[model samples]
Target: MEPAPGLALVVVSPRVAPGLMSRSAWQVVEAASVRLCADADEPLAVAVTDADLPIQVYAAGSPALLARHLVERAADDNVVWLGSADGDEGLSDAIADEVSRLNDPPPVEVVVGSWDVPGARLLDVVAVMDRLRSPGGCPWDAEQTHESLLPYLEEEAGEYAEAVRSGDRAHMAEELGDVLLQVAFHARVAEDHPGQPFDIDDVAGGLVDKLVRRHPHVFADVEVSTPEEVAANWQKIKEEEKARRPGAH
Candidate 1:
């Protein structure tokens, strides 16, 4: 089966096989269902019996270590011990009898689903700017000049820095997206100038070309010992290009 996206504690048997079960021997269970015991918490010890398989417990956080632990546990035991997959039948039967005797209760009310989300669409910031610049469009967006908007770049960069400092990955992701939008906004305004490739694609393509040229170790036959060597070679090539230009002395 395809691996599940989130965290899981999978049980395995010896010889790296799924433990004996009617279905998949190694079934996936919610981590909350599996509990860890500390020796400090309980002085008395509990031992598993022949009815149980050798238990191999592991969390998604460390798959390599988990797998190794399973292998090591399986080496000493006959069967892989997963959790208590088969609960006590005698206790279950007694519970079922008592449940059958009890009267049914009324169903509780539950309001389903959400209503807040409207929708979303993709549009180039240039198109957004052009619309804003139109005679009938937003006055606030249209009235702003490049000089008035200069601080937005720094503001967005600062937000990005704050997000990084928080160490909350999800917040950082959202903040970085805002920084990217600011970059695209600047690029859109710069595109109005003639003889300048000021679009985001132009910026990206230039970086890609420069990266490929500089990484001789990765993209070309030229060998480079250190990053310093790569930087020196890049400067030499750049100087040669400048010297070849028509206005160079």
Candidate 2:
């Protein structure tokens, strides 16, 4: 007799763009006899249907009910469950409980469809800063100007320096985060500037451009024997960059 069909639970990161999924995720989801999700409007669900695959939108009930339904369905048909961005709270444990009650439960696997890349959390920081400055968010955050935030930025920098001096790794990380928050806050404030406006991406992009341009030893063929040589090369690059700027003498 053929082995019973199994269930594939596909989890995707909200940080990642929709429709971009791992090969394994696509394969399992494509091979499944039935695709299920709680919401038809979810990015993953929409992506799946956009690819011409059929997906059923079930009314989201309690975790236990959903788990029981999934296991029962998977007993006869291969099933793919597109998990919610918030992780379908407690659903996995409920599924485990339901599976344990059966004499012969279908095999279940969790497939990671998309994962956060390095620096993905920085996106969250930007999002939070936007929220804090928006109309309905914190009044203090919404009212803060770049000039008003300068003192806090300086204070945070000092705290970070002290953290480094004390050799407290945890404190250093926390202080560094505070410094980053100031950067985000200032960027958000800049968005409201009447004369000139720029977001965090602009700030980050400029920094990235400068880093790539200055680091010849790392990014280009320039060779440096020692730290002093690297510094001298950096200074030379800085002067060259200054000269090339529109207003440079």
Candidate 3:
């Protein structure tokens, strides 16, 4: 006899934008007779109530224990497991091991309810900066101009350098975020430029172009044997690009 099938439908990055769940994920959540969640105050719980699904909190236990609890439900009906922002990979692993031990293990399907675009979280920084610089935002942030933010940009860069020297990963992350904040802030402020206005996407687009143009070895058919050769190629490409300018002599 074939073992019954079970599901571990995990919600990914739901907290990035509270309740950013996919339709298919919601359908599974709605259809499942038994829904299990890690916490009630989490974004998943909010989504569950929104979906009108009966969700129960999971007790603290080993991954194998959790897997057994969920697969047991599979014997009678479908199971939906709502995961946290970071996911529960350990539980997934436990489920796989537990299934192997069972005489007639149920088939397990792991479903990702949502997907985050690569570097999508950085876009959130841009959005928040836009809000801060817009009307009815923080007075301090709204009053800031490109010139006013220059000092902060320098300060953030220095802090990031310090983090690198100290070799503290957490500090490095925080300092890097501060530097990114300055970039996003400047991009937001640039929108007010009378001659030519641009946003964060424009900034990133230019970077992408420069990266692609300089890294011919990676993006094109050009080959380089060493990092030094790659650097030389980058300099040559940059000079060629600069020479193309109308004012270049």
Best by TM-score: 2
Clashes of each: 7, 0, 0
TM per candidate = 0.39, 0.92, 0.61
For model 1, how does the per-residue alpha-carbon lDDT over 1-249 read when each residue is reduced to its tens digit? Answer: 333222222222212212232233223321122222122112110122122322233332333443333333323322222222222123323323433443641111111111122311123454565666567978876566567677877887898899899998998988887776666566665666667647656876788987887666789898889889988988887887689889998
| Candidate 3: residue 42 Cα off by (Å) | 16
* Cα lDDT for residue 152, candidate 1: 79
After aligning candidate 3 to the native by TM-score, how far in Å is the CA of 73 from where it should be?
A: 17
Cα RMSD (angstroms) for every candidate in the order listed? 19.7, 2.0, 7.8
What lDDT does each candidate get?
A: 0.45, 0.91, 0.80
For model 1 the local lDDT of residue 205 reads 76
Error of 3 at 17 (Å): 10
Clashing residue pairs, backbone N/CA/C < 3 A, model 1: 13-80, 53-80, 53-81, 54-79, 54-80, 54-81, 55-81
Indicate whether candidate 1 or candidate 2 has the larger TM-score.
2
